[model samples]
Target chain A: MTMIVKKTTQLIAGLIFLYGIYVIIHGHLTPGGGFAGGVIIAGSFILLILAFGSDFLRLTREEAGSTLYENLAILIVVFLAVSGLLATGKIFFLNWIPKGTPGELVSAGILPLYNIFVGIEVAASVLTIFLALVIFKEELAE
Target chain B: METAICIIAGLMIIGALYAIHAKDLLSAVIACGIVGYGLVICFLLLKAPDLAIVQIVVETITLIIMVAVVLDSSREEHFVKPDGKGYMSMAAAVVMTAVLLYFFILAVGMLDPFGSGSLRMASQYINGAVELTGSVNLVTGVVFDFRGYDTLGEATILVTAVLGVITILRLKGRK
Candidate 1:
C-alpha cells in the first residue's frame, strides 16, 4: 500500500508507454502491428506496477476494471459482426465493410476496429491476469 | 545474432536451474519469468511473432498461477531458504548449462529464417482463408477462421476460468 514511484522509473515507464502508443498507431502499415503494440503498452504498465508495487496497480485496475473492459471489447466486436449479419446477409459476415482508401487510418474497414478490439482485449486480459495473481498472492502464496 | 543466441541460451540454462533449485518460491517464479523471456527472444529471432505472443501469454499465466497456488498452500518461511549451497547444485547447473547451449546452437545453425521455408504454404492457406472467411490480417484469418474451432475452445476456456474465480472467491468468503 505504501508503494512510491521513483522519478527515474516514472520517466522510463512513460517512455515505454509512448513507444507502445507509437507502435499501436502505426500498426496497420508496419511489421509491428496491434498485437505486438498492445502487448508493449501493457508491458509498460506491468513494469511500472512491478517497480512501484501493487498499490498503484490496484488503483489503476480498480479504475479500469479490465474484466469489464475485456467483456466490452468482445461485445463491441461481436456486435459489429452481428450487425453485419443483419444488414447484408453476406456469408462472409462483417468483411462487407468497405475497404476504404487503403493507406489512411480508417481505410481498412474492420481492420482498424479489429485491431482496436484486440488491443483492448489483450491489454485488459493481461492486466486482469496479472492483477488477479497479485490480489491472491497472499492467499495463494503467503 | 550469434551473441544474442548465446545470451538466450545462457539465460535459459541459468533460469531453468534456478527455477528448479531455488528454495524461495518467489525466486523460482522470477527465474521462470527469466526463462520465459529468453524463450521469447529465441522465438522472435526465428520471426515467429504469433507463436511468440501466444507462448509468452500462456507461459506467463502458467508461472503466475504456479506461484500463486504455491503461496496459497505453503508456509512462507519454509520455502524462503535453500537447503544447502552444495556440490550437487553446482553439478546440476553445469550439466544443464552445457546441454542447453549445445541444443540451441545446433538448432539455430540447422534452421533457415522461420517463415521463409513455409512461405508458399502459409500464403496459400492465408489466401484460401480470405476466400473462405474474408477476414483481413492473414494471421487473424488464420487464427479466427481456419482454426475457428480452436478459437471457440479458447474462448470457452477463458469463460470457465472467470467462472472458477467467482466460485472460489465466494466459497473462501463463506468460510
Candidate 2:
C-alpha cells in the first residue's frame, strides 16, 4: 500500500465506523437496523486492513479474539431472547422492557438492544471471514 | 418510480451479460458489481432504503474481496470455443430460460400490484405498532419483537456460514 492510501484510510475509516454505530443506535427510528449497520462497520475494518496491509493487525493472533467476540456476541443475542421468556414468562423474545416514547433514542426497549448485539455479531462474523481468507492467502504464499 | 426501476433493471441485465462474456476476470467481477449496485438503485426506487443500504455496502465489500482474489491469482479467464456438444447445451439453456421466463411472467401477473398488498398479517403490526413496541419504525418492531425468532434464525445462518468458512480456511485443524 502507498502512503497516500494509508493516510486516506486513516482519515476515512473512523468516520465509516462511527456511521455504522449511528445506524445501529438509531435502528429503531431508521431504515437500517442490525444487519446493514454491522456490514458497514465491517466494511470500515476491511478498508483499514486493505490499506494498512495484513501485517498491521497481526491477524493470526487477533483472529482468535475476533472469533471469540463473534461467538460471544451471538451468545448475548440468544441470551436476550431467552431472557424474554424467563423474565416475562409470556413468550420468547417478548418486548418486556417498558416502552418509552416513540422516536426517541431510548424508546425502542428491547429492539435497540437486539440491534446492538446483532450488529456486533454481524460485524465480527464478517471481519472474521475477511481475515480468514487473507491469512490463508498469506500462509499459502509463505 | 416504475420507469426508473425498469431502466435500472435493463442496465442490470446488460451488466450481467457483459460479466458472463468478459474475458478479463477483473472486468467481469466489476461488471457483476454494476449489476449489484443497479439493484441498490432499484431498491431505493422501490422505497426500501434499508435494503438499499445493505446491498450497497455488501456489494462494495464483495467487489473488494473479489478484486483481491483475482488480482492475486489470474487476470484473464480461459474461454473455450463452443463445439457441437456445447451448442446442444446452449440450445437446452435457451429453452430452459424461455420456460422459466414464462413461469416468471405468470407469477408476476398473479402478484398484487405494488403498494396495495393485503395486509392480513401486517395489519396487526402496523396498527398501534409504535405503542406496542415503542419503535417508530414498524419494520424494526416486527423484525426484532414480533418475529424475533426469524431474525435469530437468520443470524444463526450467518454464524454457521462464517464458521464453515473459518473451518475450511484455517491454517491448522488441531494443535
Candidate 3:
C-alpha cells in the first residue's frame, strides 16, 4: 500500500519464491511437496500484488501464457504416466527411470519429476486464479 | 504436551464458534484461519511434519482467497430476526451435534491406544518404502508411487477449478 510496504515486499518476495523452489526441488526428501511449495510460490506473488496494488496486474495480463504452462505441466505428467505404461507394460505411473541411491536428489524415479510438474501446474493455476479475480474486480469497479 | 494440545483444541473450538457467530465477515474469516492454524499445530503434535507443512500453506492460501472474496463483497451481514423456521433449524443443529458428539466419544473410546492401531500397511510402507521406491521420504513415496492415481485426480480437480475461475471472470467479446 505504501512505498515502504512495496519495497519490503519486493525484498521478501524473492526469498519466499526461492524457498518455494527449494521445497519443490527437495520434495522427494523433504516435508514440503509440490502442492505446498506451489502454494508458497503463489503466496509470494499474491504478497507482491497486495503490496503494489493492481499495477502488478500488467505482468499477469498475458493470461494465455500462464494457462499454457499450467496445461503443459499437467500434460507432461499425464504423458509420463502413459509412457510409463507403454514402456513397462505393467501399469500406469510405473517408475521407469533408474532408482539411484535413497537420499540422492535423482534417486526417486519419476517421483521428483511428478513433484516438479505438479508444482508448476499448481503455481501457474493459482496465479491465474489470482489474476482473474483482480482483473474481474477492476472491471467491476470500472 | 497433552495439556498444550488440549488448550489448542479448546482454542480451535472457540475460534470456530466465533467464526460462525461474528457479524464482521472479515473477522470471521480470520477466525477460520485461527482454527486452521490450530489444526496445523495438532498435525505437528501428531508428528506429521508433511501434513503440517501442507496444512499451513493451504490454510494461508484459503485465507487469502477468502479475504479476496470478502473484499469484493459487502462487509457487514444483515441480521434477520429468528422465526419458527430458524428455531427449528437451530434445534436440528443441536440435536445433530449431540448425536455426532456421542458417536465421536464412543468411537474414540473404542479405538486402540495411540501408535498401536492397524499397523499392517503402515509397517509395510515404513519398512519397504525406501527399498521399493528409492525415496527416503515414505510419505512422498506413498503419495507419488502407491497413490499416484489419487494425485492425478486431485490435479485434475485443481485444473478444473482454475478453468472455472477463468471462465467466470472472462468478459464478453474477449478471448
Best by DockQ: 2
DockQ winner between 2 and 3, please give it.
Answer: 2
Q: Report the CA-based lDDT of candidate 3 relative to the real structure.
A: 0.88
Clashing pairs in model 3, backbone N/Cα/C closer than 3 A? none
Residue range A31-79, candidate 1, lDDT tens digits: 4445666666667777666667667435444534777877787666566
Q: Give the TM-score of candidate 2.
A: 0.95
Deviating ranges (above 4 Å) for candidate 3: A56-60
Question: Any runs in candidate 2 off by more than 4 Å, and if so which?
Answer: none
TM-score of chain B of each: 0.57, 0.91, 0.90
DockQ of each candidate, alpha-carbon based: 0.13, 0.85, 0.80
Clashing residue pairs, backbone N/CA/C < 3 A, model 1: A140-B71, A140-B72, A141-B71, A141-B72
RMSD of each: 7.4, 1.6, 1.8
lDDT of 2 by residue, B113-132 (tens): 88886668777777878888
Docking class of 1: incorrect
Q: State the C-alpha lDDT per candidate.
A: 0.63, 0.90, 0.88
Model 2 chain B: which ten-residue window has the lowest total lDDT? B117-126
**Candidate 1 similarity to native, TM-score:** 0.62
Query: Which is the better candidate, 1 or 2, if ranked by lDDT?
Result: 2
lDDT of 1: 0.63
- Top of the candidates by lDDT: 2
B1-175 per-residue lDDT for model 1 (tens digits): 7688788999899999987877777787888888888888898987777668656755765675577567656634353445567667978999999999999999898777744654567767845754444443456555544543454345446545754664454322422
